[model samples]
Target: MHIWDVTNGARFSTYAIRADEGSGIISLNGGAARHVQVGDLIIVAAFASMSEAEAETFKPNLVYVDGSNTITHTNHSIPTQAA
Candidate 1:
């Protein structure tokens, strides 16, 4: 299990899992976790059930690619809130 304090302007945490051919997709549990938005920079704290090869290829900060794609990395950084 991975623990991340994403309150520092970061957004969602993405995980790439290798599953069955027909079950290769991302799933997000939206109960208390915040949903990631487009052009948001994210920081990865921990990764489980993922290989080193896949982890290296995966970007830390991910921007929304499209309606179909939820995780994508952006050149811009996530904005910080004022105290």
Candidate 2:
């Protein structure tokens, strides 16, 4: 998984997930913690490589959350960005 700091044009970094269910925590550990500050918005994405057959049937899970990190909705596809 990679964490993208969407609010400040910060660089994205790969990270492993930790269990903190319901804690609403999304932290950048170690030295990477400096890359973010409280209240900064971020996008967390996970990617996987699969074969042609698997790709044909795959749909990425997209989770939507509120400011508190509580999931409000979820779907497999994202809407196209508007101008």
Candidate 3:
């Protein structure tokens, strides 16, 4: 997927966005510091347009593309309630 860098005003191929050690912080592509945090989600299109959305429902720590061009969301789990 295409990732637009709002800071640098550039676009790149989004490899992944993983959470840092602490909660509510994510690392992007091994390039810079954690750019996105909890409650933040970015939508990237093929033509290099990025739209930001609030991750109120669920926040995915990591997003990557596989060999089949399918985007994968991992490293995040649903909150469990006390039984």
Cα TM-score per model: 0.26, 0.86, 0.28
Clashes of 2: 0
State the displacement of the C-alpha of residue 37, model 3, in Å, after optimal TM-score superposition.
Answer: 14
Q: What's the distance in Å from true for residue 6, model 3? A: 1.8
Write down the RMSD of candidate 3 (Cα, Å). Answer: 13.8
Deviation (Å) of 29 in candidate 1:
11
lDDT of 1 by residue, 4-71 (tens): 33444534445545555544243444531455443333344443467879866765553444334444
Instruction: Indicate whether candidate 1 or candidate 2 has the larger lDDT.
Output: 2
Residues 1-83, candidate 3, lDDT per residue (tens digit)?
56555445555565655554435333464553245433334445433333455445555455454433355545565457998
Error of 3 at 17 (Å): 4.8
lDDT of 2: 0.83
TM-score quality measure for candidate 1: 0.26
Candidate that scores best on TM-score: 2
Give candidate 3's error at residue 1 in angstroms. 3.2
Clashes of each: 3, 0, 0
Error of 3 at 15 (Å): 1.7
lDDT against the true structure, per candidate, is 0.46, 0.83, 0.48
The best candidate by lDDT is 2
